[model samples]
Target: MRLGKTYRKGGFMNEKVKSGSRNVAIVGPYLSGKTTLLESLLFVTGAISRKGSVKDSNTVGDSAAESRDRHMSVEVSAASTEYNGIRFTFIDCPGSVEFAQETYNALMGVDAAIVVCEPIRERVLTLAPLFKFLDDWEIPHLVFVNKMDRANIHVLETLHALKAVSSRPLVAHQYPIMQGEQLTGFIDMVSEQAYQYHPGAPADPIPFPESLKEEEHIARAEMLEALANFDDHLLEELLEDIEPPQEEILKDLKMELGADLVVPVFFGVAEQDYGVRPLLEALLREAPEPEATAQRRLKNIKGDTALAQVLKTFYTPQGGKLSLVRVWRGKLTDGIVLNGIRTGGIYRLMGQQQQFVNEVDAGEIVALSRLEGIKTGDTISTEQQAAIKLPKAAQLEPVYALAITPEKRNDEVKLSAAITKLLEEDCSLAWEQHGDTHEVILWGQGEIHLQVTLDRLRRKYNLPMTTHLPQVPYKETIRKTVASVHGRYKHQSGGHGQFGDVFLDIKPLPRGTGFNFNETIVGGVVPKQYIPGVEMGVREFLTHGPLGFPMVDLAVTLTNGSYHNVDSSEQAFKQAARLAMQTGIPQAEPTLLEPILRVEVTTPSEFTSKVLQLLSGRRGQILGYEGRNDWQGWDNVSAYLPQAEMQNFIVELRSLTLGVGSFHWEYDHLQEVPEKLAERVIHSNGNGGNGNSK
Candidate 1:
């Protein structure tokens, strides 16, 4: 169906922007002031009249109720503005490692990214994972060392720390001027021009201070040296002590940056809007255009057909489904149906507010409403049969889990549907119907990540949820063999009496050899039909043994039995077998067994020893550790850990490694729980009825 039509009357259809547009994502560690940077960018660009603070929850970014309540961004927030005759769409991404998936997905659609970070050297390790992602994808990025005014250490030391986490060489773009522990001004490294800061106005140029001339010379030479590595001509000039032209240095910076060969470092204090103008000018001059990004990612977006990629998905009470899509090629207009799903309305998003638009050109980021079947990372084209494949963000593995149930029993079905929508909105969320414990386990990156999802459930779906630590799937087995246990069931209360008798032999099997059943009868002592009933009874009793867990690695054989011709029945025989287990299992030396999981923990090499110590403290058996195959400067430690100890492993691991550590685990084998802990667990299970006794 043809869907081209005029949108709402007098909308942004008449407000045409320049063809030069770029999409940039602001990302860093949590509490690095990404939202504040967005506010400064918007205010300086005339997109917003007044700047809002994160404390007051009035910022355009972090507009979601969950984010505002927590005062942290939960997802990517998009805003558009024009600066220096160039259009830009800046996506503010959540810096919390728990929400890094949001930033990762948005990064795929942006031309470049501003890696906003604080000047605290101790917290610099938090940037490792994000930096690795950008480098792995070959995305051009710059580091904005924020909170420069509050820096307690030298700027060079901060740069040194940042360089440790990044794979690309870093070039200093500006040098901060400090006067008695306060930021006074900055020197542009390339032009050697000095500027003094003025609150709420452009920084005015001034003469280069003689006190910093020597230091500035050293920094500029180092910057030039880093640039020279990529250009032989520049190297020759540097080697011969011939000063390179300012224009040549700028060109090298632009070329190397756009090519993802080097990362240029800029200093700023976003709260005071310092260095924003210079940052904006650098972006305008150096950051790659959208076409360059598209060419690097998508090879065949040259066709006339409309092509776009879904970068994120959102659900609102008023608007059903909003798919945030980046138009890669061709035009996206109202009522367009791409790849079988029809788009209802098109909008230009400013934080949470939507401005209706009739048409938007390529290289623009916009929201398409009611794309029901569309999902994040999907490539859509207007051609009905066109199948185009585009790059997708890496899927994040969930490290933390919680068992959740609806607070209202009647809302069970509603909870399932709500969870579906929630997962649609945040792809990092996952859920499982645990087969052994029968718990509905919800998984995510961390505690806060799952907490935000629960809050969203309550706020958006009106479904209140209660969560608990997931129960471990534990099994039990007999330590010794017992034979010739007799069980008889007789009842004579009605016209037909029930009478059955059976003799069974129980024996221990090898570990990991699951349950087995067998029978041997002679001279028709036990009828074939009733014999099956006896086996079923034994199986049912084994499901919840004397220790209150499923029995494993054991075999039961019906050695001898008797049944009356008239009174014998399958139900009677089954009950007789169960009675035999109830009487014999306690005497068979039954013991509790807990599940052990094979865990693979990955962290920076510096934290490998800490991780090993952590595992040892938790009674985990260290199998080995080695450098991760695909990740540089990271180690993967393998261990066997009790499932019970893993409940808080992710939380503690993040605490130890600044939230960059993670692990993957699965059930490996069953081991006997320690006597002391087992006793406590048994008592707790008995009181809480968590023993899984049917």
Candidate 2:
């Protein structure tokens, strides 16, 4: 249960030799110390000479062009450091909820989390989702109270604020000692050591300030109480009014953390080095190693045994496809047959760099090169090991949808490939050929999600793509029954003559039965040879009726007709059928039908009244409203509205919530078109080359 120590004598010195590393995620709310904390980790571990400032835009993980422009992280970035001989690959993830799924995916195979938070109460609100994710997934995590150097900051007060929302115990392992307006240094509750810093000087152990002894004692006692809750032995000692030993406290912390029962909270100023050494020492000693992290279950290629799981994937020009994997059960080496193919080029990932390794063992992350035809979720195993797979990620349903098209006429293929690459990079993105609208639509979390994706398309693949609200798939149908009519066509020539005759009865069927055909012709008047021909003609005419849309839910019956014995033909019958449809359709009161969608919107409850009013104005029928957990003033509202009325609903909802609300929709049913609404739709469609209705 000891921390990551190679060997130790005469005080605790970090061991420098190890064959592997740990992957940790530095995550937090927007503008928090997430990126800065990662930079500090790299600097403290000597991975970089000095941490590059986000303001300077020279940081390793903040390499995206947009990140530099905004001086913040827009996505996840990876950087590695070797401290105490244990390699730690740190992933800095975005703080915005719009990008939460990105962070979740990056944690697929990481060992633990360092949830960074600021002192401002408002800024600390978003940490709930991140912490909830860890608890729900049973992933071990630690809270890092960042930005100690800021003026008017209270570390303990911030901790209490976060504690109110957190479900698990917030155990403070490092207590920062404040002196007037400066962060003097920190006190280690576990090791019972006091370390002080002088602005630009190195950290050194010093005597505990007697003036703050009372507060430090109370803080340490609280830490002990938190430990007792998670440890049975400590609880027993606490019941007997006896203090637990330091080794017992440290041991319990490691065990509870490895079991995902407790998260050790650390305090420090990421910009300065104050209070960081203790945090680093504790992490090296307490954080779970790769062996303790969740192992991805995947099957062997032969369906016999498995030794590996594909945790992440990267697109590489040279390697074609790179799968960053964690070997969990058995060994993997170059030329070893995996998934039935001869596996080759086993290597370890060092940041953006890769190095050839003889073999990859259980409990480490490695980037396998040239795994041709292997996908991101595949499992590779030894011929004798059993296959296992990890739980599938929760699919993120997109509330907003937009149709995408290439900017240039000739770039259609390039645009399609670019979107496919984007989908591969972010599975949270839902894309498909929208059958009703026949538009290539991309659905995402929000406006920003789509905007960022478009940016990446241009930046990564040199494809210019644009998005727009998709058009509703409206249909045309008949409203009233039309009388039967006879249609005949004939042509006379010198040698042969063509003639055909038929009578068609067009009637309105039910709303959704679509097109139906029946034949009830009397004997000899119309032969059976031209019945299908008449139906085929009716089918072609049904494609575009008076309103210029395919006709549906209509019953067409062949009642009576006469045909020449030698001149009846399919073409002649088709012409006769067309004439019958054109003559009888207008009389049948053909009308356009529009699709309706059942929509459920979730927004802060404070905006509920306004949202209800807005929906009502759009002809949305409100079903009900109910409060949702953790959304504060937010409520979930359900309603049904015409699809045409919802083209800009996503945009309107965002405006109502100030960019906090979201919604989802499904096909409800088609509703009869209102006269006024139908006029507008018809006018727009007529000018857009959809053909005009008489």
Candidate 3:
């Protein structure tokens, strides 16, 4: 690749102008100044006249109502700008871990990403997951350490902390020059030149300072050494004590960074726009174009076909449904049919506002209105019959859940439609009507994540909801066996009389054995036709046991009964059977059983002890703990915990792990609830009224 001709006075030029475009995503941990970096980039590129502050909530990126109210990004926001002649589309992705699904989804289509972060040493571990994702997918990325004005540690020390979490090598491209406690300038390692910063304007060249020459030389040598690992020519020059040309070094940086082999680090105070121009310059010169990224993903790209991938789905109060898509291959025009769905309208999105456009070219990210059945991660193409192979981002598994109901009973019907839209907007959200508990549960990455989604439901869909802790699906079962329980029913009327008598034997079955019924009516003591009624009545009675929960792991048998041939009927027999169970279950020693789940919590090894203590406090049985596969310095702690104990587990886990921990769990088995807790649950569930006993 030729690196000399790519640079221009105003902006860097592209080797191939497929659409004269480059797409990049800005991502990092929560409160890392990603939005500020985005604002600076837009302002420096002349896309916006003035910079916007996060507190003001007037920024172009975070335009959603929920985002404004929370003062954070809730979804991916896309904006387009042009530096010189090259068009650049920037996607400002959510930094919160809960909304990482949005970032991952958008990363699939972007050419490269700028990982923004702060200089806190302790919080650097939060970037580990993001780094792992970029490396796993081979997506080119560079890290920008923001909030440099407030940095307390040396830049090199901060880089050391960041290197611990990344699999790729860290290459520092710029070194900050500090005066007392403030960052005033930076040295460009590639050019071997120093520049002084002036607020609201570009940096100006200054003579190389004598005091910092040794530090600058050491930093530059380290950068060269990192790049030399992948370039034989560069390594030869370094070994021979020959300084390589600036162009050759630039080529090495571009090549290695684009191949996902090295991460080039930059320093800045994004709130003041320092280092933003140089970062943009590096992106234009080094970041891969859409064609290269597309080739890397699709593998077998037909240049003539119209291929687009939906990165996000939205429902507008006025526009109905809108899908944010990246046109990867060919042109997308209004009224074009893609994947058998007619495009209702084509639009270029600027935050929450839409600018109507006739069509959009390949490499451009835009929204398509009213495209039904198309969802996030879906690939759309002009040829309906073609099976286009495209890379898809992995979705996040929900870690927290809420049992939700409509605020007003009359909005129940509207709630379903609103939930459908909510799922469309956020792929990480999921809902289910639990069969056992008969409650509607909404699941997401964390508490705030689900809360933001709920807020959106009320704001955008006009469907308000209430939430509470989900009820555990508890069951009742007999502990002992009881036999020869007699029940008789007799009713008389003026014309006829009703009479029935029955004797039943109730017994306990092994755990997990569901209800069963049997009959041993020799010589037809009870009429054969009436036997079905007795069984039906017994099954119905078991649904609501003496403890007010469905009974399981027990069986009942009709051993004997007397019937009058003239008065016996199925109705009389059914009534008599119910009466028998009403008296027999209590005598058999019924008890409450609660569900247990096998939980595997993955967290930093440093927090394993705390996690174990947390679990033990919640009556959790520790099975084991080991280093998580494919994750460095992390452990997956496995345990069996009662569902009741898991209700608030996620909230506490995050509090202990700096909001970086997560867990997965599934139903393992059912165990009898301890007497004390069982009594509390029984009272809480209103089962005490039904004769719950120790």
Judged by TM-score, which candidate is best? Answer: 3
**Residue 233 displacement in candidate 2 (angstroms):** 3.2
Sort by TM-score, top down from the best: 3, 1, 2
* lDDT against the true structure, each candidate: 0.87, 0.72, 0.86
lDDT of 2 by residue, 63-135 (tens): 7676777776766676656876677777788776667776776666677888887667755556766776787
Give per-residue CA lDDT, model 1, range 1-694, as digits (tens). Answer: 0112122111101123224798999999999999999999999889999999999999999999989999999999999999767888999999998998999999989989999999998889899888888989999999999998788778888888888888898888988887876777889897687888888887877788888888778777888988999999999998898988876887799889998999999888899988887888778778888877777877754567888999999997798899999998889888998998888999989999999999998898999999987789989999888867788998898888999999999999897888989888899999999987888999998899999999989889888888988888888998988899999999998788998899989998988999999988888888998988998999999888877778999999998989898899999999999999988888888888988999999999999999999999888999999999867789999999988888889989988998899999988999998888878778878788554211
TM-score of each: 0.95, 0.84, 0.95
Better of 1 and 3 by lDDT: 1
lDDT of 1 at 435: 85
In the range 1-694, model 3's lDDT, one tens digit per residue, is 1345554322234455434788889999999988888889889889889988889999988988888899999899988888767888889999988899999999988889999999889889899989999999999999999988888778778988999999999988888888876778888888767778878788877777888888878878989999999999999999999999988888898888878999999988888888888788888778877878777777766657799999999887788999999898889989999998899999877777888999888888889998898889999998887687577887788878889998899999898888887888888999999887788999998888999988988888777889987778889999999998988989988666777889999999998888889998899899889999899889889888887788999989999999987888998889899999999999999999988999999999999999999999998999999999999899999999998887678889988998788998999888999998888778867843322221
Superposition error at 359 for model 3 (Å): 2.4
RMSD (Å) per prediction? 6.1, 4.7, 2.7
**Which structure among the candidates has the greatest lDDT?**
1
Better model by TM-score: candidate 1 vs candidate 2:
1
In model 3, the Cα lDDT at residue 30 comes to 92
RMSD value for candidate 2 = 4.7
True-structure RMSD for candidate 1:
6.1
